[model samples]
Target chain A: MNSMGLALAILGASISALLAGIGSAKGVGLVGEAAAGVVSVDPDKFSKVLVLQLLPGTQGLYGLLTAILMLSRIGVIGGNAVELSTAQGLMFLGASLPIAIVGLFSGIAQGRSAAAGVGITARKPEHNGKAIIMAAMVETYAILALLVSILLIYNIAI
Target chain B: MGTQYASAVAVVRTMENSLFTQSDLERLINARDRKESETLINSKNAGTLPEVWEMLRTFAPDSKELEIILYRNDFHNLKAVLKAMVSGREPDSYIIQPSNIKNDTLKEAFRTKDMDVLPDYIRETATQAYELITTTLDGQLMDSLIDTACMKAMQESAEKSGNDFMRKYVNLITVCADIKTAYRCSKMNKNRDFLEISICGSPELDKESIIRATLGGTENLLSFLGNTIYAELSGLLKENPAEFEKRCDDMLIELAETSRLQAFGIEPLISYYIAKEAEIKNIRIISVCRECGADKVTITERLRKLYV
Candidate 1:
C-alpha cells in the first residue's frame, strides 16, 4: 500500500481539475462581463451573446472529464484503489499535465477571443456565426489537449 | 495589458452601430428644409452629446484619461465665466454642457475667488486669467492664456496617462490650434510676445519656431508648416481657411478611425466619443447651412468626415 504513490496520483487529478477549472472560470467570467455589457444595451441580444459567453466554458468541462477518467482508471472511484508505484503515480501526473496546462491557457485565450466575438455580435448580429467561428478556432488546441490527456490516462499501467 | 476596458469597449462597439453613417450625413445635407433635417436627425435616435458623455462616465467613472477629452470645453466655460464676471453679465447662456466643472461650481469659484473649487487642471489658469482680465481688461490676452493652458493641460495629462492615442489626440489638437492661431496672429501683425503666449507647441510643431515663423509673417509660417508632416494642412490654410478647419477636423476623424481596430482599452471609448462629436458637428453644420440657405455643395464640403 504505497500511500505516497496514491497521494501523488490524487494530486495529479486535483491539479487537472483545479488548474483547468480556474482557467475556465476566468475565461467564462471575462466573456460574461462583456456579454452582460451588450445585453444591458440590447436585451434582445441575450441569446447571441450567451452563445459567445459559453465558448470559454468547455475547457473546464474537459478538465473535469480528465480528472474523473484519471480517478476511475486508478480505481479510486469504484472503491478499489490500486497500490501504485511512485513511477506510476508520476506517470498519472504527467498524463494530466497536457490538459492542466493547455486548458488553463486556452480557456483564458478563448475567453478573450469570444469576448471580442461578443463585440461583433453586439454590433452585427447577422455576423454572429463569423464571431462564433473565430472564437471556436481556439477550442481546437483544448480539444487536442483533452484527447492527449484521456489517452494517457487510459493507457497508464495501474 | 492594454486589453482593459473589455466591457466598456464592447458597449462602445454596440453604440458605434447607431452612429450616423456617411450616406446618412449626405441625406441630412440634402434634406429639403431645416424641419426635414431636424426630423431626419431625430429619427436617428443618436443620443445627445451630454447623454453620450454621461454614458461614458458611467462606464469608465475612474478614467482620468477620458476626462482629458473635456479639457477644451472646461477651459471654454472658464473663459465664459471670466468674461461674464468682467462684463457684469450672466454666464449661463454661454456655458456648454458635458463639462467636467459644473456650471455652479465654476460660478462659485469666480464669486468666492476660490480657485480650489475647480479641478487642479484649471485651478491655476482660473486664478491667473481672472487676475489678468480684471486688471488689464484684455479679453484677447486672457483668451490666449486660457487656450494655451488648455492645450498644456491636455498634453501634460495625456503624457502622464501614457496613452498613445490620447497623446496623439492632444498633439493633433495642439498643432492644429497653434497653426490656426499663428495664421491669425500673423495676419493681424501680432507681436512676438502675443505669438509666444498663444502658441502652445507640440513635438510636431515647436512653440519657438512657430512664433519666429509668425514674426517673419504668414508666408514664413505657412512655409514652416509646409515642410512639416502637415504640409497638406498648410496648403489648405493658404487656399481656404474654412476648408482648412474642415480638414483639421477630418484629420481627427482619421485618427479616431485607427482606434476602430482596437478590441479593448480606453482607446475605443475615446474613439466613440470623437465619432459622436463629429456626428453632432455634422448635424450642426447641416442645420446652420440649411438655415443660411447655403447650396448643397457648400454644405457637403463643410461637413466633417463621418466615422462609419
Candidate 2:
C-alpha cells in the first residue's frame, strides 16, 4: 500500500459520505417543511413532528462515521500514514457504494413518510406515538446501510 | 401445481375446519365458577387478545359474539380515552368506539385545535400520539387502505394460483369488515347522512339484521338511532354476544392451527399479527379496569384466550 492508494481510499470514503449527506439533507428538508406547516396550526405538536423530521438526519451521521473510519484505515490518525494500492482503493470504493445508493433513496422515501405522519397526527393525534414508532422502524434499513459501510471501512487496511 | 401454492391452501383449509366449535366457546365463556372464567382468560397469551376480539367481531352477530366484542370495545374505549387525554382533549365526550362517537364531545374536539384549553392528560397523550403520527407518513393509509389492498391482493393471489386459502382468508376478512360497517351505519341511522360511510364487504345479511345486531351494543349512538335493537340486545345481552365472538375467534385460531398442522407456516403469521393486536387490546382492558375500579373478577372473566 502506498500514499496514492490511501489517497484514493480517502476520496472514495468522502464521496460515499457526501452522497449520503446530500440525500439525508434533502429528505430532512422535505419533512421539516411539512412539519413546520403542521406546527403552525398546532403549535403544541412541535416535539412529535420534530423527532420524526430528525430521523432522516441519522443517515448523514452514519455516512460521516463511515468517512471517518475510511480515513482512520489509512493510518491517518496514528504516527505513520499508510497508503493503499489501486486494487485496495477500488475495493474501498466498491464497498461504500451500497450505503451511498441506499442511503440516498431511503432518505427521500422517509421524507414522504414524514409528511404522511404529519397528516395522521393532524387527524388522529392520539395515534401519533405508535405512528412515529412505525416510521422509525422504517428508518432501520437505512441505518443498516451505514453499519455495513462502517464495517467495510474498518476492515480495509489502506 | 406448484408445491408452494398447493401447500398453502391445504394448510388454510385444515385450519378452517378445526376451529373451536360453539360448545368450546361456551365452555370457556359460560364457566360456572370464577376460577373457571379466570383460568380461561388468564391462560391466554395477553398479546393475542385484540386479534381474538377481531375474529369474534367477524363472526355473525350473536349474544356470545357481542360479549367478546364488548370486551374488545372496552379496551379500545380505554385507549381512545387515554389517547384523547394525552392529546389535550377531554376524552369524556370523545367517541370511544369505532363506529360510535360521542356526538357532543366529538363536536367540541373537532371544533377547536387548541391544546392549552385541554386537560393535562389529554395534552400529554395527544402530543405523544401526534408525534407518532407525524413520523409514520407512509402508514397514514395503513388502517383502511391496507384492508382494501389485503383483499385485492388475496383475490389476485387466489385467482392466479387457484389457492382457496387466500380465498377463504379474504372471504372471512371481508365479511368481518362488512358486518362492522353495516352495524355502524345502522346505529348512525339517526343522523344517517352524516355518519354513514361507504359500505363495501359481506356477511350478506339484510340491512335490518345488521342494524339490529350492531346498533344496540354500540354506546352513545342510541340517541341518534332512536329505539332500534336496544330491546332485543338488552333481553339477551349477558351471554349471547360473548359466546358468538368466542366462536369467531375459535374459527380463526382453528384456521391457523389447521394451517400449522398442514405445515403452512404463513397461516400462523397471519394469526400472529391478529393476536398481536389482541394483546394490545388486553393491555388496554386491564389498564382501564384498574382505572375505572371495575371488579377484578368481572374484568378477568371478560378477557379472551391468548393466541401466542
Which number leads on DockQ? 1
Best-matching candidate per TM-score = 1
Model 1 chain B: ten consecutive residues of lowest lDDT: B1-10
Residue A94 of model 1 has an lDDT of 92
Candidate 2 ranges beyond 4 A from true positions: A1-3, A78-80, B1-308
lDDT of 2 at B58: 41
> What's model 1's lDDT at B139?
98
lDDT of 1 by residue, B92-116 (tens): 9999889999999999998998889
Give the per-residue lDDT digits (tens) of candidate 2, residues B82-134.
45544666666644443222334433443474445433323333334344434
| DockQ-based CAPRI category assigned to the predicted complex of candidate 2 | incorrect
What would the TM-scores of all predictions be? 0.98, 0.34
lDDT (Cα) of model 2: 0.51
lDDT of 1 at B83: 96
Model 2 C-alpha lDDT per residue in residues A7-88, reported as the tens digit of each score: 6777777777888788789768766765665565457777877887887787777777777777667676665667568888
Worst 10 residues of 2 chain B by lDDT: B1-10
Model-by-model lDDT, in order? 0.91, 0.51
| Fraction of true interface contacts that also occur in model 2 | 0.00
